[model samples]
Target chain A: MFFNISRYLGRFKLVGCVVRNFLILLVGLVFSVNALANPNLGLPPLNIPADNPQTAEKIALGKRLFNDKHFSADGTISCASCHQEDKAFTDGLPVAVGINGQAGTRNTPTLINAAFFETLFLDGRASSLEAQVLGPMLNPIEHGLQDQQVIVDLIRQDRSYTEAFRKAFAIKVDEINISHVTKAIASFERTLISGDSLFDRHLFGRDHTALSSSAERGLTIFKNKGNCVTCHEISWNNALFTDNRFYNIGVGFKQLTPVLDKFIAFVRQGNNPDYFPLTAVQRSELGRFNVTKNLADIGKFKTPTLRNIALTAPYMHDGSMKTLEEVIDHYDIGGDQNRFIDSKIFPLHLTTQEKQDLVAFMQALTSSKSPNHPTGE
Target chain B: MFFNISRYLGRFKLVGCVVRNFLILLVGLVFSVNALANPNLGLPPLNIPADNPQTAEKIALGKRLFNDKHFSADGTISCASCHQEDKAFTDGLPVAVGINGQAGTRNTPTLINAAFFETLFLDGRASSLEAQVLGPMLNPIEHGLQDQQVIVDLIRQDRSYTEAFRKAFAIKVDEINISHVTKAIASFERTLISGDSLFDRHLFGRDHTALSSSAERGLTIFKNKGNCVTCHEISWNNALFTDNRFYNIGVGFKQLTPVLDKFIAFVRQGNNPDYFPLTAVQRSELGRFNVTKNLADIGKFKTPTLRNIALTAPYMHDGSMKTLEEVIDHYDIGGDQNRFIDSKIFPLHLTTQEKQDLVAFMQALTSSKSPNHPTGE
Candidate 1:
C-alpha cells in the first residue's frame, strides 16, 4: 500500500510540472500577442489594469451593459444616450441631454481617445476611466441614479447580467456590484482605439503621398505658424494631439467676468457636492477652477484630443462655436481677452488659404475607422 | 643578466598596475565632481564635447579672445560688439551693427542660455558652437576677416595669446589654428549658464514666496492663454523655454511675401555662401528656408530663449518691437498678417493689466546674477 501511494505521488508531481509549464507558455503567448500595438492607429499599447483583465465575455457583457437603458432612472436613457456610436461616441449635441429632457451645461467631448487621457472630463475631475463612469450615472442631469446600490441591485436582479458577472468575474449573483459594471464598461471603452488616419499614414508610415499637398502645407502652418502643436502635442513616436493640461482660451470668460467675485466666493464655500445644480452656468464657466479652486486654474478647461474632431461639432467647453472655421477664427483672434486668459492665445495672422489649409490638416486627423467604427466610417 | 632583466620588468608591471588603478580613480572622481549641475540655475550638466573638454585655463583664454577686437578687420568689432555682457550678452539693438557700422538684418539674440541651443544663430545655419564662431568672424559685414589664415596668423604673432593657447590646449605655438580659437571661445560660451531666476526658484525649487502674486497670475496666462509654452518648452524637470524648432511668427514675413517667389528662385539657384551680402534682407526674411531649401521652412526662425529677456531690448528677428509692451502688442495683434505666418500666432486680446503681469512674469525670469553676471544685476 505504501509503495502504491509513493508511485501515485510521483505521477501527480509530473502532471503538476506539465501544468506549470503550460501556464507559463500561455502567459508568454498572451503578452507577446497583446502588447497593445494598434498598428492601424500607430498606437503603442492599451493600459489594461491587472485586476480587470479583458476577457471576450467581459467585453461583450460591458457592451451590452453600456447599451442597457435599465441602468438609468428612466428606461429611455443609458450610457449610450449621450455617447452614441454614430457620432464618434458623441450625441452631436451642444450639451448632453438626460431624462425628462434635462440639459447639461458643458459640451459633450468625444470618447475616441479617452483611454489615453490622463484625466477625464472638460474640468479634468475624474482621475481614471473607471471613476469617470460613476460621475454621469449619479449626476442629477445625467443617468440620475440615487446611489451605488441602485446600479448593483439592477445587475443582481437581471438573470443575463448575473450570468455575465459569473462568466466575467467568477462571482456569485449577489457579488454583482457597481465596480464590476464599471470595469466591464471601461474595458469595452478601451477597445475603441482608432488611429488609422490619412495624417497617420503620411506621418508615421512615411507614405508621403497619403496627404494632400494642401494638407501638407496646412500641417506646416499648424506646426509653425498656428502654434497649435503646443497644446495638441505630437511626439516623435506618437501623436495623442493633446497636452492633456488645462487652459482658459477665452471661450466663455465674458459671462463669468461680471460675476467673477461672486462666483469665486460661491466656489470657496465649504465642500458641496450639489454645487453643480445651483450653479450650472457658474460651474460650466468656472471650468477647472470648480475642481481645484486654485486662482490660476480659473476658467481653465482640459485640452480635448483632436482625434476625430471633425465628427463631433459645436466645439468648446460651452458648445458656443459651431463650425471648425469659427473655432479657428476665435483662436485667430487669440480667444476673448480676460484677466485670467492664457497668455499663449495670441492673434495668429493666418491668411484665408492658410486657415483653409489648417482646416484641411485637422480634417486629415480623422481616423479612417471612426465616426462609428466598423459601421459608419 | 636574465635574472636582473626579469626582476626589473616585474617591478615595472607592479608600478603600471598601481598607475592604471590611480588613473581609473582620477577619471571617476572627475566625472563625479564635474557632472554639470548648476544649482543656481537649476540647469542640467552642460554638454561638453568629448573632443574639446572644459578646462579653467581654456575658458580664461576664450574669455580674453571673446573681448579681443584685433580679430576684426578694423580692431573694433569683437563678439562683444554684438553680444555685450552688460546687455545680457545682446547688443540691445534692433539689428546687429557689424564692422564699420554695417547693420545685419536680424536682432542679436541673447547668449545667456545659448550653450543649451541645439543649433546656433537666428536662422540656425551653424551646426555647432564651434562652427558658429567662423560665421560672424568671416562675414564681410561683421568682423570682416579676409580668411581663416588672417586670424590664425594674428593669433601666432600675439605673445600673450600664443602663451595662453599653449597653456590652454597643451599645443606648440605653431600648432595653433582657427579650430583651437573656436574651441576655446565655445568652451567659454558654454560656461555662460544661468538658472537663478525668481521664477526658477518658485517653479523648480518649490519656493512659493519667490514670485509676486501678479507674476504668479501672469505665469498662468503665459502657460495657458498665451500658449507660448508650445515653442518655449518647460519640461517637468527642466525649463529650456525653447523647443529648438523654427517658426514664422510674421516678424519679417511681410518683407518676404512680395518677393517670396523671387527669393525662392534665388535660393534655388544653388549653393552660394556670399548670398548673405547681396540678398541681406531677402536672406534674413527667407529664415530657415535658406538652410534647408525646403519650401515649408520659409519665414521660420529658431525660437530664442526667454531667459534674461528683460535685459535684451528690441525683440523679434528684426528687433522692431522696442519694449516688452510693444512685443506683447505685436503678438496681441497676431503678428502682422501674412500667408506663411505661423497659425499659432493669433490675436491675444490681453488687458493692459494682464500684459503688465506677463511682463512682470518675464522680468522674474531674469537670473539674479545676469545682465553682466558677477558685476551687474
Candidate 2:
C-alpha cells in the first residue's frame, strides 16, 4: 500500500511537470504574437492617429494611389517616384527633386519610422502626416496638382477607385476627399517600421554578442563622449536615435537669419504663411521658426533619426555631406561657425578608430530587414 | 535449366532498360547544367570579352565599385544610383538624373542581360560592356569623373580594393588601372541575366500550365497578328525578343536628321566624332548614326530585349512614353510617319481586346524574378 501511494505521488508530480511546460509554451506563443503586432523595433506602442485607424483595404488603396502618376497635374510625378522604396523612401538628391525636375531647398527626409515624429519636415511647419500630404501634392515644385479638386475628380472618374474608396473609408463616391487620401497614406506609412536591427538585438534582445567590438565601442562614444544621445535620445527600453527637437548646428545659419528677418516682416504684414510657395519657404530655411515665429528657433532644424543612415546618404538639411565620414568630420570640427549655432555644438577630438567605430555603430542601427526595402519581405 | 534460361532473359531485358534510362538521365543533366551555366534567358552563349573574364573576386569588387560614390566627381553618384537594381538597373526618371541633379537626354537603360547585346547604350555607340563602363563614369553629366585616372586613383587608395585587384587579376597594387575597373564592372554586369518568366517556364521548362490562359492567347497574338516577332525575334528553340538589329520607329527623326547632317559636317571639319561629349552625342539623337555615321542608320535605335521590360518603364530611347498602353498605342498606329521608318512597321488594326491581349503577351515576356530588381532575387 505504501508502494502504491508513492507511485501515485510520482504520477502526480509528472503531470504537474507536463502542465508547467505547457503553460511556459503558451506564454512564449503569446509573447511572440504580441511582438509580431507592434513593430520589429521593440519600441513602445506606435503613435497611431485616433481619426485614422489602419486597415488592409486602406493600405492597399494607399499603395495604388501612391504609385499612380495621374494624382499629379502633369501626370509625371508619383509619390513613389521621390519616396522610392529602394532608397529608403528618399530620392537620392541634394534637394528633393519634384515636378518638371524642379528641386526643393531641403533634403528629402526618409519616411522610415516617420509615424513617431512629433512633427514633419525640416521646418516642423506641419503638425500631422495629413497636414503634410497636401503641402507636397499642391506645392508648385512638387506633384504640382492645380488644386485638391484635381485628385478628387481623378478618383471619381475611376470606377475601380470609387469601389476602393468606398471599401476603405465606408464613404460614397462624392465623399472621397483629401481626408481619406492622407489617412490611407498615413496608415501605410505607419506600417513602414524598420526594426530588429543588430543594435536593437544587442540591447533589447539581451544578445550581447549581437554587436561586434567595433560597434560596441562606437555605441559608448555616441552615448558618452560623442554627446549624440542628448539630441538623438536613448530611452530605458528603446533607442529612436532622434530627440524630435530642433537645433542649429551652424549649417546655413548665417544665410538663414536674413531670410528669417524677411519672414518675420512678412508675418507682421498680415500675410498668411500658407500662401507662401515651397521655394520661398525653402529659401527662408527658417527651420522651427516657421512653426512658432519665435526668434530662438531660428536656423534650427529637427534632429533626424540615425536608423538606416547608411542607405540614405547626403545627410543634413541641405544634403551638404555626401558621406558618413564627411558628417562625422563636420561634427568633429565643431561645425561651421555662426551666431545661431547651438551651444551644444562643440568639437569632438575623436581618434580615427573611434570615428570608424561610431560610423559602424550607426550602420549597425540599420534594420536587418528593412520592410519597405526592395528585396525585403 | 528451363527456369534459369527464362530468368537470364528477363534479367537481360531489365539491364537493357536500365542502361537506356541512364543514358537519357545523363543527357538531361548535361542539358540542365549547361542551361544553368550562362543565364535563365534562352539565348546563345554570351559574348564575354576575352580580356575581362568573370571571377568571383572580380564580380565582388565590381559590385562594391558600382555602389561607391567616391568614383564620381562630387562623391555622390554611384553607377548603382541611376542603374538601381530595384528598377531593373534603370532610374525611374524619364531621363537619367546624374551628379548635382544633371539630367541626361536618353533614358537609363537596363543592365539586365546586357551580356547578350551586340552593342551597349541606346545609340549602340559602345561596342562592349568594358567600353561602356568608362562612358558613364567619365561623362560630365553622369558620374562626372574628370578622367579615368580618378577611378584608378580611388581604387589605389582603398586597401581592400588593392587586395581584391591582386586576387582578381594577379595584378600588383601599382598596376591598378581603368582597364581593371571596367573589366571588373563588365564581368559583374554579365551575371545579371533575369529570365524564367511564366512564358519561359512554359516554353523551356515544359510547364504547360505555367501561363494563364489570357497570357497564352496574348502570346499567340504576339507571334501572329501582332507581328512583334519580326523585330523581337521568336525562334522555336529560343525567344530573344530582339533581332540584335536597329530600326527607326520615327522617334526624333526630323531633329536627328538635322543633327546627323551637322555631325557629317563636323566630321568633314576634322573633328573626330569620338571626341564629342556624351551630352553632345545624346543631343544629336542620331541613334546608330553616331557609331557608323551611315545615312541608313539614322533615327534607328537598337531593338532592346523584352526580358524584364515590365520593370524598366518610361520606355523607348527617349523615355517619352510612360506606360505599356502608350507603347502599344504607338505600335498599333504603326509608329509616327518618318522617311526612315522600318518598312515592316505597319498598322496593326487591333481591337481593344486584341490590344489588351498583345500588351499582356509583352508583359508575359517579363522575368518572373528580375535579377537586379530591388524586390527580386
Candidate 3:
C-alpha cells in the first residue's frame, strides 16, 4: 500500500513538471518571430514612427504621389523631377530646376538615407520626414502649391487614389487630408535604406579581399590625416558616414560675407515675410542660418552622408564643385577660409596618390542594393 | 540634296535621345532596393545605434552570454533567470529575485520592444541598452559580478566564446572586452520586437475581424472616458501605446509616504555609499526620484508599453496587482491616491462591463509573434 501511494505521488510530481514546462514553451512560442534589420549596412533596425507605420499599400500610394506632376502648379514637374533615382535621388544639376525652368537656391540633396537623419534639408529646418515633404510641396519655387488644402483637393479628385487611401489608411474618401499624403511619401522614403556596400563587406562581413589596397590606405587617411571622419563619421560597428551636425566648411561663404550683417539683422526681426523666398544667389549663401535664424549658425550646413558620393556630382549645399577631386582640393587647402569655417577644417597636405585612393574608397561605399521604385501595379 | 540632309539631322537627334534615355535607365538600375520594416506593430524601422550594429554571429554570441550562469558570483543564475523569454522577457515575481533569492527593489520589466525605448529601467536611469546591461551584471543582488574585468575574464576562459568573438567582431582573443559582450546581447534584445498583435491587425492591417465588439468598445473607453489615451497614446498611423513619459499612480506610495522626507533628505546629501543597494522594500518606493534625485520626480515611473501586456502580468512598476481586472479596478478608482499622484489619475468611474471590455481589449493586444530563443547551435 505504501509503495502504491509513493508511485502515485511521483506521478503527480511528474505531471506538475510537465505542465510548468509546457506553459513556458507556450509563452515562448507566442513571442517568437524576429523583426527586420539591415545587417549588411551594420545598421540597427529603422526606428519607425508610431504615427506612420509602413504598409505595402501606403508605400505604393506614396510612390504614386511622389512621381505625380499634377501636384505642381503648372503640372510640369514632380518630386521625382529633382530627386531622380538615377543619381542617388539627386537631379545631378548644380541647383534644382523647378517648373518653367526656374532654379532654386540650394542644390537638391540626396534622399538616400534621409530616414536616418535627425533633421531634414541642408539647413536642418524640418524635424521629421513627414514635416520635410511639405516644405518642398508648398515651397513657392519648388512644387509651388498655394496651400495644404490644394494638395488634399488634388488627391481627393482621383478615384483610384481615393480607393488606395481607403485600403491603406481605412479612412473614408472625404476624410483624406494633407497629413495622409505626406505620411505616404515619408513611408516610401524610409524604404530607401542603402547598405550592402563593398566597404560593409570588408568590415561587417569579415571579407578581407572586399576592398582594394588603395582603398584600404584611403580608409586609414580618412580616419587620420584627412580629418573627414570628424564630420563624415564611421562608427566602430556601422558607418552612416555622417555625424548629422552642421558645420561651415566655407562653401558659398564668399558671396555672403559682404551682406552678412544686413541678413542677420533682418532675420533677427521675426515675421519678415520679405526676407523669405530670397533670390537663388542669396539663399545659397544663407545655409543653416535660413532655418535657425541664429548668427552663429550662419553658413553652416548639414554634413551629407558619403554613402554613394561617387554618383552625386556638384557637391556642397550650393552644388559648387563638379567632381570629388575638386571637393578634395578644397579640403586640401583648408576650405575657402572664412570666419565661420569649422575648426576641424585644416590643410591636409595629401599626395596625388592619396587623393586618388580617397576617391576609390568613396566609390566602394556605393551600395550593392539600389533603391527600387516599385510601381505597385 | 536638301531633303536628304534634313533626314540625316533627324536621325542624329533620335540617336542622341536614345543614348540619354539609356544612361538614365542605367543610373536607376544601379540604386534599386528597399530596407526592412515592422508594419504589423505600427512601428517604424528600428533606429540602430551606429556603434553597435547587429550581426547574426554577434546576436548568437549575446544569446550564449545571456544564458550562461557562470557570470554570476555564485554561478546559480544568469540574465535569463529573471528576463525569461516565456514571460515576454520578464520574471512574473513581484520583484526580481537575484542570487540566493535576494529580492530587488523593482519588478522585472519586459524586454519586448525595449529597443524602441529612449530611457531604460523603471527608474529611467540607463540611457542605452549597452549601458543598461552592465547594471545587473555588477549589481550585488543581481548577476553579482565584482567588475567589468570579471565578465571579460569569464568569457576569455571559454574557448568556444573566444572563437565566436573572433568570428563576430574580427578581434584577437585578448581584445575581448565587456563592451563587445554588451553589444552582442543588446543586438539580440533589439530583435525581440513584439508586434502582429490583434489590435495592430484591426487598426494598421485593416482587418475588422481581428477584435470582438466588446474589445472595440473597450478601445473607445481607453481613448475617451478612461483618459488612458492621454498617457497610453495611440497615434493615427501607429500605436506604441505609450507617450514615453513618467507619472505617479500611487502604487507603493503608502509604504513610502511616512519615510519619504527622510529618504529625500538622505538622497539630496549625495555621494552616500550606505544609501546604495537599498532594501527591496525601500527601493521599490523610490521610483523616478532615485534616478533624478529631485523632489518633484518622486514616486514616478516610466509609462510601460502595452504591446504585449496580456503576456506580462502582475502589472505596474512594483508588480502589486495580480490580474487585469485588479489593474482596471485600481485605475477606475483613480489609482491608490497619494500626495504625489498624477492629476490625470482622477476617478475613471468605469462601469463593470466597461472594465471587462478594457481587459478584453488588452488581451487582444497579445502579439502573434513570440520572442524566440535562438540557441545559435
Highest-scoring model, DockQ: 1
* lDDT (Cα, tens digit) per residue for candidate 1, span A262-361: 6556556754533534356765787887788665677899999888788888788888888899999998988898867765677887899999999988
CAPRI grade, predicted model 3: incorrect
Candidate 3 residues lying further than 4 Å off, grouped into runs, are: A1-40, A262-278, A371-377, B1-377
* lDDT (10s digit) by residue, model 3, range B1-377: 53454455556698856655666576556532111123245664578999988889999988888898998999988999999888888888888989988988778999888888888988889988888999999999998889999989978988998999999999988999888988999988888886767787787666788789999998877765676765676654467777677788778878777776676677667756246545557666767877876566778899998877877887888888889899989988878877677655656678999999999899877776664312210
Instruction: Tell me the tens digit of each residue's lDDT in model 1 across B197-277.
Output: 878778776678879998998887787667678778665446778878888888877776666666556656764533534
**For candidate 1, what is the DockQ-based docking class?**
incorrect
- DockQ, candidate 1, vs. native dimer: 0.09
* Model 2, CA-based lDDT: 0.77
Best by TM-score: 1
Task: List all candidate RMSDs to the true structure.
Answer: 24.8, 33.7, 31.6
The candidate, 2 or 3, that scores higher on DockQ is: 3
List the candidates' TM-scores in order: 0.52, 0.45, 0.47
Rate residue A309 of model 2 by lDDT.
86
List pairs with backbone clashes in candidate 2: A374-B374, A374-B375, B86-B374
Residue A357 deviation, candidate 3, in Å? 1.0
